[model samples]
Target: MARIIGVDIPNDKRLEISLTYIFGVGRKTALDVCRDLNLDPGMKARDLNEIQVTEIANHLQKNYNVEGELRRTLAQAISRLRDIGCYRGLRHRRSLPVRGQRTRTNARSRKGPKKTVAGKKSVKK
Candidate 1:
């Protein structure tokens, strides 16, 4: 369990993939970070030296607004849109798809399970 930038990277994974365990870092960013730090992408996280770990932490802290900061910034942006009553905001408020996906027939993942409506029974006179 190697802790970098306040996040514990999985020791089993390669350094490149393990770094992505930290929030706001993806595959591409992880590769870029390794390249910038002059680290071998295939190296395991547990094999990182103290200086290399420190360099990674410093680079992440200085160059990227990650973890809590990223979450807060995203939340604030969404809140601002909602407060302004924009169409996208309204979609978010209603818990509907915001990217113009057809909701009438699809979007089951977001809409959840459908409820059965009661119907009148036909009487045989």
Candidate 2:
């Protein structure tokens, strides 16, 4: 396993994909980081030398807000939305999907299991 920017990256994955395990880095940002550090995107995380890993860490720390900082920023954004009583905040408060996903059908994963209704018995004639 390679530790980059205080996150543990899986050893089996390519450097580009492995870097995405870090909090603030996505696919595009991972590619950008690799490019900036002159690292091969196809290289495995475990194959990176200590110097390369150090360089990557330095680059991330200098140029990007990641890990705890990124998490705190996201939390603050969500809190602000909730405080302002926005529609998205209402969805969040109600525990529904916020991205305009159809709740009438495939949102069962978020909505949890359905309850079964009991039928009334008929008397014999």
Best candidate, lDDT: 1
lDDT at 67, model 1:
88
Tell me the TM-score of each prediction against the true structure: 0.88, 0.81
Writing each residue's lDDT as its tens digit, candidate 2 over 48-125 gives 999999998889888999998889998999888899999999887777888999987777777778756798989999
Please give the distance, in angstroms, between residue 14's alpha carbon in candidate 1 and its true position after superposition. 0.8
RMSD of 2: 2.8
Q: Report the alpha-carbon TM-score of model 2 versus the true structure.
A: 0.81
Question: For model 1, where is the 10-residue window of minimal lDDT?
Answer: 108-117
Model 2 residue 45 CA deviation in Å: 1.4
Q: How do the residues 1-125 of candidate 1 rate in per-residue lDDT, one tens digit apiece?
A: 88887899999899999999999999998999999988999999999989899999889889998888898999998888799999999987887888999998988887778867899999999
lDDT of 2 at 34: 94
Give the lDDT of residue 86 in candidate 2: 99
Once superposed on the true structure, which residue ranges of model 1 sit more than 4 Å away at CA?
A: 119-125
lDDT of 2 at 45: 92
